[model samples]
Target: MATGPAKDEKCCLVAVTLDKDTIGQGPPDVEHERRVAIYDLLEKNRFVLRDYADEGPYNLRLQIIDRKLVLAVDRQDGVPLITHILSLTPLRRIVRDYFLICESYYAAIRTAMPSQIEAIDVGRRGLHDEGSHLLIERLKGKIEVDFETARRLFTLISVLLWKGQGR
Candidate 1:
């Protein structure tokens, strides 16, 4: 039988903050989504640093600096940990597509038929899952997170990448 980590040994993020400048407020729906992501992530997640496994639950702050994604981590008591950085280049295309699909999904929820709404939702979720996998790949060997955690983090990252009301 396989065993998971003990209760006290579980790792997770206790808090999360996004750079307000980069992730400024936008459409009501978009802003709500960002808030919901943070809420869900804080409500539950698994975040374990590769080399600093035994030191969580941690606090995370994400910032987009110089077109790069900066993942700043710290211990529960605010002690600094690793700051993993990632280039947003690889995620650009997917994030764009995800936004487009989300726009479609939101619009469909109002006027589109049930089947149409379901179809659009399916596509939206597919893109979300793809983005999550990409995030997992991007953070590989640096920070470890499960699929759901990646999904929430991707939400925050997409919000960070948002360009005002343009999209």
Candidate 2:
């Protein structure tokens, strides 16, 4: 993770990593390489990527390491489904607005079922272990999120977290 005293503050910025290999026991080296690729991509995009956890492609996972934190949700295929970040300081209202807008992106792809959507909301709120499996199961058939949208959402959310709300 990045070394900075700011990391010690509450929330801080977090990242979650999921790759193709974690879908099953494909290959450790392959998984590592894929993770490396993602880390590299984020860095190339000028975002400071951080290592958080290795939850083995669970529906949801949360981890805090090296002063950084992560909240991630994985797809059934073990790819990264979604991720959100929160920083400690700079408690600017803009950050909250960013989260809300990103949350709209999430809500856009949410299932019609209120309970199921609520479960997803909890997951994004950093309640990973709460209803992860249930949320994943509920999300399988209900949410019809397109791949393009998912990809855009992923990139946008990452950019927002790394660079803040700078247009």
Candidate 3:
């Protein structure tokens, strides 16, 4: 059995990269969200790949290739680990719904009544939670991530899926 990180040791992302071509096509808001998510994820996150012996601080490069989400992971020293590919098909509907609710929430914050804004915000959070849960489920065997980490990753994924469409 492979030994994982120590209980008190936190496995964090040392570097993160997104596909310039695809992410560049996203709007300003997508860029903003991606920046925030990357910052938050690197600041603190729990990520472990089971059955692997390498130690990390890891580096991750994310991209959408042929309708699949590809994660090219490496050790801090640039040693390659595994390139994990997950289908974006399962996440399409949830990402679309989350983006729609987010748009509503942002618009409501600008002009809607206080109660309406709160309601929209609540819905937005709910969808966000759902997306996070779905991500965790999908990554079950390949990688292990804490809920907070998954939530932040979900934000990044959502941002990548701009225009309410899969990347």
Candidate 4:
């Protein structure tokens, strides 16, 4: 009887976990966002290791360990595949800027005119796109994922990083 991750949880290795101990369930809204991101990512994503493509569907665990973002990849049956450690330093500014613009956008939506909301939204989307690209570049040599996958992953990262949670 091998004791480890169950056999039934295997769904082409698309499962992703963000160490609940580290990230917590978060506030209600944040938790909801995280759940949505996970559901959307698993519903459809293209995640493949640069060299270990054949050994997937890969289960991914995203966590901030030792103050660095850690991407631990493994087979569904719990076999270790590859792990990628990325510095949070590169993304700190972008995520910070993203959050700032998000606050402005949220505030504008309730009080500002339609055109003001639209402008803020445009900036928000731009920052989102930029963060996605930066994540892709950071994972360039280690993993192969589509832009959408990167976008979804960035959303999860953003959630985990929300308001002092990165520490």
lDDT of 2 by residue, 92-161 (tens): 3333444454455355555457776665555454422222232233234423223332232233233323
The digit string of per-residue lDDT tens for model 1 on 83-134 reads: 9889988998899999899899889988999999999999999999999999
Clashing residue pairs in all predictions, respectively, total: 0, 3, 0, 1
| Residue 90 lDDT in candidate 2 | 29
In model 4, the clashing pairs are 13-57
Measured on C-alpha atoms, candidate 3 has an lDDT of: 0.77
Assess the local accuracy of residue 57 in candidate 2 as a C-alpha lDDT between 0 and 100: 18
Identify the superior model by TM-score, candidate 1 or candidate 4. 1
Predicted structure 3, TM vs. truth: 0.87
Q: Which stretches of candidate 1 lie over 4 Å from their true place?
A: 1-10
Structural RMSD, model 4:
4.7
In model 2, which regions exceed 4 Å deviation? 1-88, 111-167
Ranking by TM-score: 1, 3, 4, 2
- Identify the candidate with maximal TM-score: 1
User: What is the Å distance of residue 75 in model 4 from its true position?
Assistant: 0.9
After TM-score superposition, the amount by which residue 106's alpha carbon in candidate 4 deviates from its true location, in angstroms, is 2.8
Instruction: Tell me the TM-score of each prediction against the true structure.
Output: 0.91, 0.21, 0.87, 0.83
